[model samples]
Target: MALSARELWRILEPVHGMIYFVPEAQERFAALGLDRMAGYFASRAAALGPVSGEVVVATFYNFNPVIVHAAVPAAWSVTTPAALVEARYEAVGAALRRGLGELADDVSELAGLVRGAAERACEVPQGRPLFAAHAALAWPEDPLLVLWHGQTLLREFRGDGHVAALLLEGLSGIEALVVHAASGEVSAEALRRSRGWSEAEWADAVEGLRSRGVLDAEGGLSEAGLAVRARVEGLTDSAAEVAYAGLGEGERERFVELARPLSRAVVASGMLPFAKR
Candidate 1:
């Protein structure tokens, strides 16, 4: 059977996501005077070229704007966007090299496949602000970095579509996190803390979801909420499918086959702390 876009994401996400959790990346960011949250906001948003916190709030679409405001603009003062970008690439490369070891030497083929899809995503950059910004950056020379950059672009492309999907359901950023927590995949406390949403803000979003019949009395997803979640994920996956249009089914399967073990190696190396979450 052909792999779906969501399945592909599941397989490839670890490769790119490791950068956020690895100590190497954090150390690099710290050297630049960016704390953990500030590093995250600044490094990820660096491709947008020192954009304001408001732009990060809009494009990121999950974090509390207050946290974003605390990071960006201020972060730009500590380190230029270009410097952050270079630091992130260096960090990701170091992390991948340490995590992948021997597998790093054999990533050219996988990188080529993922880069093809990422380039395809770049061609239709309308409405995908984050993806477009990353796409505007020059491609990395190393195959491992290429693979990482490709997955980053694809992740942002899917993320932009997901924001649109959430909006279609009239879900605010906090509300979307609430509904996701209600699905039991992640705890509400974790989401709230990670996104820097206060308890009051979370309660308001929960109350709003309950009033809309998306959550039941116990704060779990109601049938309607499940349907809404399904629709949002479906829309996201459908939108992401466009990136794979250039790949034949055989090639897509090949990419997954090759990428799975590498991603698993990254996961097994314990570089991706969120994988435990």
Candidate 2:
């Protein structure tokens, strides 16, 4: 379902706790340039449906279900943050529209300025500067920061120092496990296999998430665990803001230039190196 004006606003917001989440996203978008990704974000925004409390909840969950669960109930304060992000965009978009009205002959430069401004505003670099304006127009201040912050948390994927997190972090050695704990598929198995552990070791890893309620008997994401997973999924846009915040005025342009090139490198370089490898 498409988000109503209010629902859209809820998904977009200003937030204090998010930067340093998933940073690769910002770099990727910048390097790809604005045109490549704007349509995607716009589509995502459109697909999100009306921003009810549940929709808002899922927004955070999609980032990294675990993050949302860990921060549970605390992360639901949507109204205030949403309002702030929306308002800022509205004011800016209105100004830009007026300037566009007067400068028909200056369309190219005007568009460039608008694009640059939106890029900076969304903290997302170039790929879809207009998406930010659309976000601003669609939902006001909420668009700039909330989605950005929520997505970052998910991709950064932190585990609790508690049982499940600690075990999964290692995923290499353990004994006790339920029979159904063997469905990680390649990615999950890769997590265990790459660790170079035996079957018994992988079983133990499954049990850990199970015991902590992070995984079900079959090792799929449980409801609570899913929430955390959601929190991190939409990490790209959120991290862009942090990248922007860190850039400062002096480094901003340089940062954008680097993002454009480095993002291409991430793909060209192939799969990222495994920290364990």
Per lDDT, the best of the predicted structures is 1
For each candidate, give its TM-score against the true structure. Answer: 0.97, 0.27
The lDDT, on a scale of 0 to 1, for candidate 1 is 0.92
Clashes of each: 0, 47
- How far residue 4's Cα lies from its native spot in candidate 2, in Å, is 25
* Ten contiguous residues with the weakest lDDT in model 1: 268-277
Clashing pairs in 1: none
State the lDDT of candidate 2 residue by residue for 189-265, as single tens digits.
Answer: 44434323466756666677678876776677788655544443223334334323333454444333322232233
What CA RMSD would candidate 1 show? 1.2
In model 1, where do residues sit more than 4 Å from their true spots?
none
Q: Which stretches of candidate 2 lie over 4 Å from their true place?
A: 1-186, 228-257, 269-277
